[model samples]
Target: MPTSATLAQPAAKPASRRGFLASAAAPLIVPGSALGLNGAVAASDRITMAAIGQGPRGQFVLGHFLEQKDVRMVAVCDCFAERRAAAKQVVDKHYGNSDCAVYRLHERVLERKDIDAILTAGGDRWHAVMSVLASRAGKDVYCEKPISLTIAEGRSLIEATRKNKTVWQCGTQRRSNPTWKFVVDVVQKGRIGALRAVTTSFGEGPWRQTGVPTEEPAPDPEVFDYDRWLGQAPWEPYSKLRVRLWRVNWATGAGAIADMGAHYFEAVQWARGNLLELPVEYDGAGMFLKKPGINNIPYFYNVRARYRDGMLLIMDPAPKGVRYDGEEGYIHILDDGRVEASPKSILEGLPDLSKLPPPKGHWNIMAPHIRDFLDAVRSRGTTVSNPEAAHASHVIVHAANICLRLGRPVKWD
Candidate 1:
């Protein structure tokens, strides 16, 4: 129930569970599952996790984490009471127990030392700050993408993880998909000759807010913590439309370009083999909706960035995925897990695409990615989509967004 300002204070370190167990007055009866017997993961070997935010996307990703046997989801947090209750039900159902804790404030979840990692699938505004707080609390983070609202916030997250030695995984799961791996491999192997350009499509910009109530309505305090939900974002009057379409507003989200562009840009960065570098110049232009409303994001846009090596990265209002263009041929990867290459012969010598296990769904490629994060958490290793790569990819999107907003070109040193 604390305000966001009060929640900013450092959380108290959790008491050691071992100390408590040693001083117990009564002997404890342990189940076979708790002891790792009967084909169960041992209590000590399991990774305790908590989830923040349980919207549709949050619930989808949380379901994947629940599928991992080594991950024990103990808590669920959200600003919405319904979401918290629903998420707790799912967690309890998965473990067949009613012990899953639920909280309205994320700080309560972060204060628990028993939680080894935090899954942040909240709004774009909360992604960076939540990850920073979790890292400082000595918890690993698996955060959904467009991980930060701004380049500065992204850098702050990178620093926080490094300082805390936290294993952070950005939710750009494409890196773990075998299909994407194959695409990157082919491009890296020169099957496409020299990688001269990369092009990707982002959805059309957000439309102007219309057909919504003009007057601010009082929010139900018990049902939703509206103040906390707007954390770090500029204060605006309560509107269901605003909460529903937060991604279209500049305060809470960067736009369609950032929402979907982050994935495509990450792929482009991976293909270019420059996850740590930035393009020297960025130029973009977009058309804005003329309607009078809250939504201010561009409705159409075409953005371009030039790497120092003269290679280009282009993003426009097209379809969903990326294309790698080279001297000899080009390869295009769509969101539906479909792949097309020009001169078709270029795909001949590569690994047999037919042998690869087809993905369950477009976004269902999350299980393997979650597995990678859990492996890294146990081994103290790095994940495929670490903070550095995430930040680099985000920088490109943020810069392009800036260019489009400014209606001019921007340069990076």
Candidate 2:
């Protein structure tokens, strides 16, 4: 739903052996001013990092990492030649250094022992694989969600990160929103009284990439790496719309249910503190757009996820926000940045975190979430949205998709 007000502001592939080794091993030297004592704050303790996937989203995240002092962009990798060069240009211009390397294969970037962490967005299907490989490479990971294409993949991602003992962050950045967090506290802290059910409204269809033609076109494998872009996902012919925004492409993503659902779902998981488990059942129905029209992804969906506690999560397409109904009253967190309640007094009486400090406005929603990840990378502490929690949220959304596709309710363990 891109429900976070901050997100309302705006809006990759792999590589080879010798080529990979050379590209990944590129220099990640940190400036002396950023050096601190025990961890990344100090000169020698700086975090040398690589960015995988150089699309708009990839570059968007790289923009965030670039502004941080103690972190170095050692290398940039992507399937697209233009993106690879563009990302490197941004980094080089910022640092006034040409040491940053660009690579077609992310494997080489991972192989580099010099990199301490990675900020990656390698598409939905490649998420688990990219993260798992990075974890195994002894690097901390900041991955965009939905974290996996399937429940099994999510499980594997969790296990891999746990085994590797690496810091992991799921890019459900709304965890940093004070108002969102306050609403969750209101629900869980009994301020709402005897919670009954939760309702989520997210826009349907990520609407295929714009300016795309009606038919598939000849792909340039050399420049775009079509095969690598599709990766292990169900194969589809090269289409202009596919890679532009995989979140809307069924071959690469699970549609809007998983796209916008990732953010709104995390709000539910956070409020209920149900990040480690999924609902007991799923009942969903949706109609998809005709293939070759506005992309093959589904266009509309209404799903109900029933929890073990008899709480129902009603998901719809609209308005884009989370609503909680309790015996006493209902609290609605609207995407328009307003917190409404049946009894305005309820919210009026409750203390909002606005006064706590730092101020909440614009600030690019990912700032706090990314900040949390960086801090954890230093302290080795748990992140607000850890892999376990992220996986659980992904499972709920994926299960909803499964239910929609099957045209029947599903039983969840």
TM-score of each: 0.91, 0.84
Residue 173 in model 2: lDDT = 75
Candidate 1 C-alpha lDDT tens digits along 124-166: 9999999999999999999998899898999999899999999
lDDT of 2 by residue, 1-413 (tens): 33222221234135568888997899988654565634435657677889998778789889988878768887888988898989999999987878687788787788777789998887888878899999999999999877887889999988999999999998887778777787888888877788889999885445534345345775676588988888887666677755565666556776677876777778887787766656889987887655444355556778999988888989888877889999889999876556778876667667764553233343245677888998999999999889888887888888998898788999987
lDDT of each candidate versus the true structure: 0.86, 0.79
Candidate 1 segments whose C-alpha is farther than 4 A from its true place:
1-29, 205-213
Q: Which model scores highest in TM-score?
A: 1
> 403, model 2: CA deviation in Å?
0.4
What TM value does model 2 have?
0.84
- Taking all chains together, the TM-score of candidate 1 against the true structure is 0.91
Which residue pairs collide in model 2, if any?
Answer: 1-260, 14-105, 15-105, 20-108, 35-41, 35-42, 35-43, 36-41, 36-42
Q: Which portions of model 2 miss their true places by more than 4 Å?
A: 1-41, 208-222, 290-294, 352-363
